[model samples]
Target chain A: MNCRVCKKKAVTAIPRHNTAFCADCFDRYLMDQVRKTIKEFRMFEPDDRILLAVSGGKDSLALWDILTRLELDVLGYHLDLGISEYSRESTEKTRIFAEKRGYRLIVEEIESEAGATLPVIAESTKRPPCSACGLSKRHLFNRAARQYDRQVLATGHNLDDEASRLLGNILHWQDGYLEKQLPALPAEGGLIRKVKPLNRLTEKEMATYAYLNGIDYVIRECPMSADAKQIFYKKILNDIEKESPGTKQFFYFGFLDRSQKMFPYSPEASPPSEKCRMCHQPCYTDICSFCRLRMKLSPFPDPEQFNGTHPDVISLHTED
Target chain B: MPESKEQNPDETESVQENEPRRRAPTPIKVFNAQTGDHLEVPFQKRVSSLLLELGIDSETVLVIQKDSLLLPGDSIDPRFEVEIRPVISGGSGR
Candidate 1:
């Protein structure tokens, strides 16, 4: 079939748009989508240093590629969750990608820095793998951004990811997560702004861009994580998307576009956040989740003795 | 004569002796992980061609046939159910 742009032989088709394009056109289309999303959401200025949270996965790598191509000030930050082979490979891929591009990547080790790895934390607490893993990564990445003095913390959360998360939140009626679900979550207090520029593109689209651009990313699945809720939601969405193309986009982008204005209900009236006494980051209780978790996992003679030693306060949580 | 009787084929144009009158579309099964679609693309085609039929880009998905990733230029054997999983699917996204 002929390409929709140049009428040359088509390389790919976006069935939702009923459009197909050759390699050059497809690349342009993908980058343009990212650019448009960033601009519309006002995620960050070109001058702003975006601390990208990379996991050696296609989504983050693709985000890095597009941001770099746009000549935006972007840096890579990867946390080694110490999941053995998985962490090793992921960190290596992230490092190599940034090195090849001459971009700086800050690596954080969970064990060496936090006194515990994700598996260790999971085993210790009754929290599931995702709960502990998500909590640590969010806090670490936030701290990484603050330490580096970056203005924005960018993540490679794409359309399918957002939609699936939204589905899960809706299914469970998690208004708090739903309220914060958007392309950009405003920076409040000490927390830096969190932006997801690839939210407009699908997981499929991101992978396509990564493959065509020859970005090296980890193809193997993570060794220590399971999201049964997310899996179920994604499957349900996938089934819907199969019948109705662009359902994922409509579900996610629709929420971002019209959620606040449509439903003016303030669902996130939990309580005024007080800064954690130890780290001075905003938290509901006396200590933040990170500080609390750190205290629980710290090996010091007294957890209070190492209060200032555990780095800075942090925040930001995604369903998956 | 016997020769005329033998030569008296159907009024249609003469066809190759070994050739079938038509090439029916081969039925090949496909499973797309992104959309959770189980599809029967009724045709024998290359990976690239099947992608075109499915309205998916060759770069968008990794074609797996019997646990082996298929290349864009590879032909799909109808007997094998090809699993077309999106290359950039959800992972342990922290």
Candidate 2:
């Protein structure tokens, strides 16, 4: 097939958009999409320094490439969960990519910072692996942004990630999570502003872009997420999307347009009234979840004896 | 190699003389990037049909042939090697 714009040879097809593009056109199209998404959501100012949470995956790497191409002031941040060889390889890929592109990168190892890896934390606390990891990553990402003086934190979450997450939240009637499913979340409380530039792009598109742009990334999934519910939701959504080309986009973008406003999430309704005694971070209780987790890992007294709250609800953040 | 007990020289010669000689089409070698499995399948028709035969959803993966993305309606040449890369990712970033 010929390119939709240049009338040359096409390299990829976006079925949902009903158009195909050559390599040069697709790259331009992706950059334009990122710029449009940023402008539409008012994600950040051009002068604002951004800290990107990259996992050495196609989405984040592609986003980094686009942002750099756009000449935005962006630095890459990677959190090593210390998942044995996986963490090592992931870190290597991120570092290599950054070095090759002359992009500054910061690597934080969870084991060194928290006195334990993600697997250890998950096992000791009996929390779900993903939950523990997510909470830790969120805290660290925010902390890193603050430490580095960056105003915005960008992640590699694509259309499939958000759509599947929305499906899971809707399936379980997790109303609280619905409000948090936007392309941009303003910096509130101690949380750094989070933005997903690739939210409008699909995983296939991201992968294709990475391939065409020669961006090397880790192709394997996290070993801990073998049977994650997120994967199942994605599969179900893909089945629906195959039958209806634009259903995934409609379901997610439609929520942002109309349904999201119906279920408003007001952070002020129950803000972090108190600060954690340990880390001085904003939290509802004396100690934050990250501090509580560290306390559990340490030889100190049990945190439960003081806060009277269970370990599962250690964090002030509520996850679906 | 042992010869088949049911083999008949006269019958084989007669069948060979009557049937037209036609070479079988080469099968496309597909590599599943997610599972790291190698498989071969006939081109059949388009990318969509090929994915259907492999029991993979077209939405979840991009079919790559000679480093180019193939559309569902794009016909793949059997001589080319194809790679099926799954785009679905989950859990926390490692």
Candidate 3:
């Protein structure tokens, strides 16, 4: 079949979409989307120190490559979730990839630093593994960003992830969560500004970019992410997209376009202003959820004694 | 004087006078604890009074009834339990 965009001979078939684009066109399309998102959102300043949250996954590796190619001052931050061999391989790949590209890398192992692993937290909290993993990853990323004095924290959350989260929030009518889910949400009081330059890019395009650009990434899934709600949402969205081409894009971009005015900016409602009590990081409470949970699981002094204090006052209720 | 009053009162009337009136128990409503804001109007108080007791700014507070979502211009009712969840910022507020 002839390439759809460039009229060149197609090398491979895109079975799902049935439309093939030449390698050059595909790369241009992905880069254009990234550039458009950055321009539209004013995501970063020219000299900003962007810390890419790399998970050795396709989405993040592609993001790192694209940002580096764009000549943005970017580094990589990888949090090892300590998932047996899976985490070890992911971190190794991340380190190797960063070293190959001559990019500075910061790696934090939750097990070593927090003295607790995801399995331990999941068992103790009786919650899904992804919940604890996400909490820990977020905490570690934010803390590391501050320590490194990075201006922005970029995640590899693609169109699929954003759409699923949007759908979930809409299903529950969570205004607070919806407010937090915007592409270019205000940095708020204490939070370092975060930007998703790939918010406009799709999963397929990201994978294609990574594949075509020869970016080394781990293809395995997170062991603990097997039963994640996002996986379900992604399947549902993919099914809908199969029925109607560009449906996901329409839903996501349409929401951002039409609902722009509905969400009025509340300057007073900044995120960073909420300081973490214990670590004094930018958090909603005195102590962050990670620190609070860690302290709860730790064999430190009286847990109740720390309750209602600046950092520990956030969650007094123990799961058990 | 006490002896005359006792002589004038009927036994049934005295028994009725000695009985105490019973009142209904007040309902307690808990708000969304995630935000740590709770609004409770004890069956006998105004919302402003409750806010004063909670040490919250009455003007900035969104007084919501128990089990109902907060909306604009909704009057605070004593019959409904109120829960107030504070909206927390995402990060440090500069």
Candidate 4:
């Protein structure tokens, strides 16, 4: 059968869609989008070491495959969130995949590094575990990259993720967040430059790429992420995509194509403050948020007691 | 961290007037604040707490004040009204 999109000789039959793409064309289409996004945004320099945040999921696995195929100097960084059996399997799969491809992989277990598991953290904080997990992942990724002297950290975030986040930012009119959501964030004094090469590809495209490439990855969702807010936005975007086949692409690429003319870059904008006392990463406060939260989760004073009316609120400080 | 009383007398006087003497500091109201449960802490509290609250390093949230952005190490006058805006994801997608 001929492929519907590329009109090439079909490889395997796509179960539900009843259409198929030739292996070469399918890989090319996905990789081309990534390469275009990289070039369009100048995501990386020729000599920079890129730490690819791989989650042992299709999106990230596909991203690593493409980066390697493109001959980009890249390594894989996976955060082990310690989600019961699921996290262990994902970690092992990610490790094996990286090792087979001769790629360097850095796996950091949160339980070991922070001495707290996700469930424990969630129970103590009353906040969803995903938010804390994301924060820790980001914090550790940047710190690891800096330690390795890698100048760029690449993530598997694709077009769907980008569009969902865009919608969230738009709903709240979060200018600060919107400003930093560009494809390529330049390297500041303390931060390693971050890029999302898969920003142009859709979730479907990534899944297809992963399957076609025969990359081993975990298909299960994080048990803790079942009720995440981002999941709501993703579902909304997915519904929109079902109604409009290329809506996600149109939204994200449209922004990328017109961002320079439509938005004036803020000159006074500085990289986030890196003065976190605990982590010594860039932060606006003396102690980093991760450390503070960890401390809060530990045997510390109650946060509710600190709440008071404005004017008196300043006097409320956590007694160390 | 220096106590308010330890600062220079001239600086201390200026802060003393603005300092919250009887109650917790009121959140500097922004027009149409972001939705969700709005817990408005003082700019410093928001910054300090959010760093831990969000489990993010301090550099993730950018704080702009007094025509200059404060670094993590930079000393900020608690008296100055600080704006708490999250540095979020960006692009042109609607």
Best by lDDT: 2
TM-score of 2: 0.86
Question: Model 1, range A107-130, lDDT digits (tens) per residue?
Answer: 889886567888898888767777
Off by over 4 Å in 3: A11-19, A266-269, A272-274, A301-320, B1-94
TM-scores for every candidate against the unseen true structure = 0.79, 0.86, 0.70, 0.68
Can you write out model 4's per-residue Cα lDDT over A129-184, one digit (the tens) per residue?
76677777777888889987788999888777788888787789887777777888
Q: Single out the weakest 10-residue window by summed lDDT for candidate 2 chain B.
A: B85-94
Q: What share of the true interface contacts does each candidate keep?
A: 0.16, 0.62, 0.00, 0.00
> What ranking emerges by lDDT with the best candidate at the front?
2, 1, 3, 4
Question: lDDT tens string, model 2, B10-72?
Answer: 998999999975977677789988778999997566888899899887767878888778878
DockQ of 2: 0.42
Docking class of 1: incorrect
lDDT of 2 by residue, A1-320 (tens): 78899998888888899899999999889888888999999998768999999899899988999888888899999999989988898899999999998999999998866678988988988988898898888777887898999999999999999998999999998877786778898887777788998889998889989988898888878888998999888888888877888999999999999755677666654456776765556677777787777767764434453353433544534563
lDDT (Cα, tens digit) per residue for candidate 3, span B14-87: 88888884865464454643344554435535554555556653322234464333332234565566765332
lDDT of candidate 3 over A13-120, digit per residue (tens):
343354666678767767888999999989988898988898887778888898988999887988887778878888999999998879899888787656677778
TM-score of chain B of 3: 0.42
Q: What DockQ does every candidate get?
A: 0.19, 0.42, 0.01, 0.01
TM-score of 3: 0.70
Best by TM-score: 2
